[model samples]
Target: MPKRSNYWLGAGLVFGAAFGFALKGIFIKSAYEYGIDTISLLSLRFLFSVPFYIFILSRKRIQEESHPQVPTITWLKLFAVGFVGYYVSAYFNLLGLNYITASLERILLFVYPTFVLILRAILLKKRITHLQWLALGITYLGIVLAFLKNFDAHQQKNIGLGAFWVILSGFTYAFYLISSDGLIAKLGTTRFTSWVIISALFPTLIHCYIENRLDIFNFPIPVYIISMSMAVFSTVLPTFMLSEGIKHVGSGNASIIASIGPIFTIFLATAFLGENIWLEQIIGTVFVLIGVFLISWKGKK
Candidate 1:
């Protein structure tokens, strides 16, 4: 594909991934209503998704008839990255959701873009451009605007702790985006994502085993259905799309594109979860879109 086409493809993939992930919060909230715990829910998600990952890997391997051997170190690095990105980040996020609304969770997660930008600047020695700073400020302001009402109405005692957890979730995920960049370029998004998700599956299983037992089958039918949807739509599909998105857009722009996630999640939550949509969220969504436009506009021109 030409450079322009590649960029647009990446943007589309990221936006699609964001939409999928936005739905995750709703599924999680719904499952929680059935008394399903975080570890169990996560276990079910991976249980449903892991088989597909393995199938993809095996098929790709057979098709290549023995591909070039990856360095052992690189494989190990991929596992480690996946552990942080998927397992740890997801653990914190699911647990955080226990204490916060789905809409708040989405906005908190949206902060990852700023984290990605800052990580690139500090760790990779990338220059922090003035435009990026402006974009970052606008994006964060939108987030604050989006969540302010929830923050006020929140009667949950754990809201502060919940915010802390989701913020950590964003931070760890930023590291994933940063670390996965070179790997995605080298391994291709499909192969890299398949392996990493598989890698993350181990820890999830282990955690569930130690903390929550693998009783996913014991969940109510609604919980099972929601978990399956989370696995396919939110986990498997979005994971690959995000990997490919980073490949095309670079992590910084891809993360910025992800800011749309809050808007998506807010609407989804309002519709299905019976959450109210306030004027503040609308204003916030507008600002977030403007920030995205500011970041993406130059590329199209």
Candidate 2:
């Protein structure tokens, strides 16, 4: 494939991943309405997601026999990756939803690109390009403008803690992105995504077991339905898309592209959750589009 094709393909995949992930805020809030705790809800999401991953892994193994067997050390890294990416990151993200509005949570979580910028520079020794700096600045400004009105200053207690949790979620996920960005290139996107998600399931299940939250059969049917939706649409699909996207466009660009997630979240919130869109948010959305255009445009010199 041509370089231009790869770039646009990667951009498109990351955009789709962002959209899929943006749906998660709505999914969690809906399930929470039925009184499911965060651990249990996460457990259900993992459980619902695993079988599909297994199917994918199995199919890939049979069809793509040419790739070398993965090293044991890499598997270890994958386990650690899974722990950070899925378990720690996901757990905190859902936890924050309990304390804050979905829009605010998305805003805080989207801050991960900043972390990604720093981590990539330190870990990979890659310089931050001027375009990325400009894109990040504009992207963040848009998020702030878009969210400023929606987040109530007078909201109930623990807003600070909630913001911290979601920020933690983003920070940990940046580590995941940096770690997986390289792995996905080496191990093949399908195999790496499936194994890491499967590995993450272990810690999630163990935590659920320790919490005595593994009783999946008792949730209301709506909770099960929502969890299944999250598993397929948000967790499984987006995870694969993101890894493949990183393979195509590299992690920093992917992260910036995904900053669109928060905007999508608010739009989805307005559509599904009856949230109102403000004029400032519309202006912010325009700025976000410009940032994205800067990232996606091919004429950067």
Candidate 3:
């Protein structure tokens, strides 16, 4: 594909991934109404999702006609991603969701773009473009402006702790975005996504076993349905799209593009969770769109 086409395709993929992931908060909140805990919900998500990845992995392996040898170091890197991206970040986000509204949870998590920019600069010595900086400034200005009134209006009692957890979730996930970019480029997004998620599955299962939360089947039927929905729409699909997104746009640009996620989450939260949307938020959404467009259109990937 042409470079311009690649960039637009990647942006669309990231946008799709963001919307899918935005629904995850709604699904989790819905499942929580049935009294499902974080670990159990996570376990069920992986259990339901991993089969799809395993099937993909096996099919890819067969098509290749032989196992390609991966270095021990590469395996180690995938494991690290599994640990931080899947286990710690996911757990923290879900923990925060328990205390905060789904809208707030997504808003807090959107801060990952800042972390992504910082990590790229510090770790990869990647140059931050003028457009990216401008976009970042406008994007966050909108976030603060939109949420300035939100904090006062927010009714969650443990907002501080919840915000802290969600911020940590953003931080860890930013690291994953930075660190996994090369892996995605080298391994191909489909294969890399499958392996990384499979790596994630082990630690998740171990945690479930340790906590005696392995019995995911005991959940109410509605919970099971929601978990399956999240696994397909949120987990499996978005995971690959995000990987492919980074491959084309780079982690920094992809992060900027992903700011749309909170917008999607907020709307979904309003529709499903009855969260209120203020006029300021609508204005902020316009600002965010402007910022995202600056990065997306002003460059050719």
The lDDT for every candidate, in the order shown, is: 0.84, 0.81, 0.83
Please identify model 2 stretches exceeding 4 Å from their true place. 1-15, 123-153, 241-259, 280-301
2 or 3, greater by lDDT: 3
Model 3 compared with the native: what TM-score?
0.84
Task: Encode model 2's per-residue lDDT on 1-301: one tens digit a residue.
Answer: 4399999999999999999999999999889999999999999999999999999978887897576877888889988998999899999999999987776677667666567776877887968779877977886787677656656545436867887788889999989977886787778778877888888899998898888747768978999999999998999899889978978888668866886887889888778876566787677766666665565452233
Order of the predicted models by TM-score, top scorer first: 1, 3, 2
Candidate 1 runs further than 4 Å off: 1-15, 155-157, 241-259, 292-301
Report, for all candidates in order, the number of backbone clashes: 0, 0, 0
RMSD list, candidates in order = 3.3, 3.8, 3.4
What's the lDDT for candidate 3?
A: 0.83
- Per-model TM-score, in order, reads 0.86, 0.82, 0.84
Determine which window of 10 residues in candidate 3 has minimal summed lDDT.
292-301
